[model samples]
Target: MMNGHFDTDNPDKVIHKGEYENSFDNMREIALAPNTHKFVLNFWTEDLKIELERIRTLDITDNLTKIKYVCNVRPYYYFQFSDPDGNIIEVTGKYTPKEGQFV
Candidate 1:
């Protein structure tokens, strides 16, 4: 939800908080911005391969990392793509625990 105060000078214009009316900040400059921050989250599961296979059937342009077997450290995956905008939508499943090796 977008909320703002009415511009004091223009009675009808909505100005964002901390912004003044008639300021250069009101200009529209659209462009794909470079990602300067990193945000990564993981979902752990014993059936990593099952989950990966299930994800594959969905309508997704990106992919879930590995789909063979959950047999390593950190079987659940995450991936940050190297595209200009650094596509992080390519959800990756990394290495999970090996047999008898609990991680």
Candidate 2:
């Protein structure tokens, strides 16, 4: 994962890597910083609603979480929440690629 890079030529390709920089607590602090907390994670599913519902049932608290469904520029759904150490996690539905867009 450390040696991997996202293909700039393909917007639909997703990258996966393990958390290796800091401990969960410190990562939480970094994630909370303005302009640094945003990390888009894509999940593939045939039924996005069902996947969303399953994520909603987890033991996540609302105080440190935000969820929304957006359809303006493109149609998609996502939820952001802080992990046990306060690091924000964004779980988003599959990607709908558009020409000239990086997403």
Per-residue lDDT tens digits for candidate 1, residues 29-73, read 111123322333334555544555666666353423433322122
lDDT of 2 at 34: 71
lDDT of 2 at 99: 48
What are the RMSDs of all candidates, in order?
17.5, 10.9
lDDT of candidate model 2 versus the reference:
0.44
Give the 10-residue window scoring lowest on summed lDDT in candidate 2: 1-10
TM-score of each: 0.32, 0.38
After superposition, which runs of candidate 2 have C-alpha atoms over 4 Å from their true positions? 1-42, 63-67, 71-75, 94-103
